[model samples]
Target: LLTPGLRGSKAPAGQNENLQGLKEKLCLMGDANSKNYRPACSLCPVNWKWFGGDTCFYFSEKEATWQESEDDCFSHNASLLMLKRKSKLISISQISQKRSYWIGLSYGVDGWSWIDDTKLSTKRMDWIDLSSKQNCAYLFYRKSRVYSENCYEKYPWICEKAAVQLI
Candidate 1:
């Protein structure tokens, strides 16, 4: 099967299909850190300097409301709560144990979308269920790492400043 945005002149016959199958297989195994989660400092794909915790501080910027937090991330050309890998999720849980922080999740456009405008579409990816939604944004606590929150709530947050690299 040919996947959209995967066709190229150099691609071998059936190569894209095989690749897609492999990707689906991996996704079915849950995230990388499903069994045990941990926290650590690392660079995020969207360019935010991540410090494993419940909240990541941006230089001198202090905490703010969920909307304000989202705006702050946007000012830096980044978004809050975009996890590129499972280890990052573990780190987030290890970083802080408090009220849930706001993420880039929103209920505007289609049913829901990321702050970066990416549509929420994933069959293998798992999300933390909080109040009454399956596709809402995610927040991390020192003890747990998946929970939903109202986008208008005030909470300390972490935002991705830029993309260091794209995979």
Candidate 2:
């Protein structure tokens, strides 16, 4: 099947039918003015990750340090998961079962904050106390909880961006 946005100069017979099927299975088209309409759709192409809701998540299988993971996500025009809402956090936790992954939270001179510089809200976080030396935060998939770890430690990471429409 042809991947989205990779259409050839000429489609073989029945290609239009196949494309329709692909769209029905893999894409969710929302009203242009709806809250679900995402700006990222203009830039995203086929093979991009698509999760339900307004955000798309990319779970990296390769392990890397927290900084490295952040860089990788940046390269993809995304950031490590910020998880602003408790419901979003819980949904991500459920989807990432049993596989701890680096998130966007970290500690710096200013104190704990997301990579975007937003302060980490204790009221919304599910933190597990760890050693003072562990300054980076990760999602502990087994229990769907957040925990601190050394920033240099290598682990798989999750990247998130606004959901996009497949061209």
Candidate 3:
């Protein structure tokens, strides 16, 4: 009701002075808990990592075939990681930590393509076999390169999807 005594802070006016003052003092002394800091809002799940600014990626710990991995991603409303930018490839490569991951690339009758059927010209890869034995592509044996491998081989995969804005 517009009381002058309570007009300054949103707090109850009495408790805030002591608590806020103490909290500020504690925060100044490196007490992280005193600030009640929270992590940034994340659209990705706890097990997923947000990458490329707009996508959420899930790096599987369990190995699966290309088809099985794709199926798993589909079940999660996502797809295998589809990358085109060399810079993005490098970013993921650093995070790969020397472990390989199946990407969304594969060879088909129409040449190499991403899972979404986008044609990928190979300025970023080599030894891309057109053989039916090794049609699926995986990432990070060498930094920033994609290598084709047997589609039936079991390997960890990455699933990616667009992060939705939570408003």
Candidate 4:
């Protein structure tokens, strides 16, 4: 049967020496205890802003209209933050205190929906005023609830994107 170092015939003398050198180099690199060895996910990209739960979140300090915020997120290859899980609210609240940040929800012809066109359910939202005339939704940190605001009004925003997988 064919095997390494015995492919059809024995490797030439010089070829064997080259293979041995390569093997030693690979062994050194593969050592787990080596100081140079680091996990693939040890460092996230500087632009990711914040990383959690396989997702990256960015909180903007500058204020912008809801549409402008959406555009900004798109430019970064992300979208306006859409909290699908209730648990994420706590994380968001801790990051933003006494400030309102634009999310993805907005009232349109089909009622409230995320910028990605996903419909929002009343059961999943904590709205402060359901009857507000505003069309865009923002989170109020103090109450840890959502409130409708004029879409034209400028406000800080949050963006979200899927975390990069480490190879």
How well is each residue in 51-164 modelled by candidate 2, as lDDT tens digits?
A: 565577888878999999999999988899986677777788777846899999888898888889998776734444434667999888777777889889999999988754
Off by over 4 Å in 3: 1-42, 122-133
What RMSD value applies to candidate 1?
Answer: 12.2
**Which pairs of residues collide in candidate 1?**
39-91, 46-162, 47-162, 53-95, 54-96
Query: Residue 79 in candidate 1 has what lDDT?
Result: 66
lDDT by candidate, in order shown: 0.54, 0.75, 0.71, 0.73
- Residues 44-126, candidate 4, lDDT per residue (tens digit)? 34655554445788888899999999999999888998866668878888878468999998999999887889888667355
TM-score of 2: 0.69
- How high is each candidate's TM-score? 0.52, 0.69, 0.67, 0.70
Clashes of 4: 0
- The reply for model 1, stretches above 4 Å from the true place, is 1-63, 97-99, 130-138, 163-167
Give per-residue CA lDDT, model 1, range 63-120, as digits (tens).
Answer: 5766777777777665677754567666665654465666666666476666777765
Q: Give the Å error, residue 48, model 2.
A: 4.3
What's each prediction's clash count? 5, 2, 0, 0
Candidate number with the higher TM-score (1 or 2): 2
Residues 44-135, model 3: lDDT tens digits: 66788876365888989999999999999999889998877766777777787577889899888987899998898757344333444578
